[model samples]
Target: MTDSRDVVRRLREGFAWRDTPVGVFADLSGWWRDPELLRMLGPSLAGLHADASPTVVAGIETRGLVLGPLAALPLGVGFVEVRKEYRVAGEGQRDGADPMLRAGTPPGYQDGGLTLIAPRRLFRPGDRVLLVDEWIETGAQASAVRRMVDEAGADWAGVAVIVAACPPEVGERLGVKALVTDDQLPG
Candidate 1:
């Protein structure tokens, strides 16, 4: 079975530094298809926030969707999809104006960023949630989720990521736990 060290190695080998309009971000189109990577990543990442004993796991977007549920599985919690540029059908069961729909963008993907959309009902009042993703750059996505949690009156349990490259302030402010640190990234 793959271990956390193997996961780190795979991530570094898979990802490359790319200078985007926003800034330097990791082009992580590297290990998406590797089920083994995720299998190893799930429990390891889950371990980060499992101490909080959250009732739900919310994944931010495409990457969040993959890692969130995978991490949530071992945590024995349900997974929630924080959709981007998409809306869920039958949510709120209302036409036109659904109070459940929420949309915004993370600060990290400023230029040509995708509009993120999620249902407020995905979480409930007082529900504890652990947010999961593969990478965190600016804590913008994590902040958005924190806002949603506040709007719903849910408890922001914690944030977890497979790799991190953002400033230490981001993690300190959000209390995010990353499996891989900045030094581990391929420079």
Candidate 2:
């Protein structure tokens, strides 16, 4: 049987890990430049959908955009974008105004470079959300998204990442399931 751990390992190996710079920003952004990275992660992410229980997916903006929808589709659930642009969190702000305005990444994320939004649009009061992202090295983005989910009054079902550089211990603190490890990436 195919296990999640194996799947994670496979996804990690899909990327050209050797090409990434040692720093956090460079490492994260560098993954985007490698086409093979996505090719590898895409299938592994699909595997996540196949194995997961039914649930709505909350994708982190920009990066998580693709990962979120792909996973949710297999589960027959709707996908929502958790934006990094900031908008006021209250009524009378013009519904459907600018979704991106309020959906920013969080402060202190990736060394405090990213700021997440205060409002979450794709959730109901009691909705269950499974947060998915491209990778989780520091958990900054994941934590930021979690805060947004909580602010939206949605229940966080779980967290899934395509690659996890830190071990399970680090992931556990941020409610992350490192479906794959950094070492799994191609050298």
lDDT of 1: 0.79
Name the runs in model 1 displaced over 4 angstroms: 18-25, 85-93, 96-98, 101-109, 112-115
Best by TM-score: 1
Candidate 2: segments with Cα more than 4 A from true spot: 1-13, 18-54, 86-108
Count clashes in each candidate, considering only residues at least 3 apart in sequence or on different chains: 0, 26
TM match of model 1 to true structure:
0.81
lDDT of 2 by residue, 4-39 (tens): 555544444334423335633323455455565545
Structural similarity to truth (TM-score) of each candidate: 0.81, 0.66
lDDT of 1 by residue, 86-138 (tens): 44544455576645546465544766555556677778987998999887888
Question: lDDT per model, in order?
Answer: 0.79, 0.62
Clashing pairs in 1: none
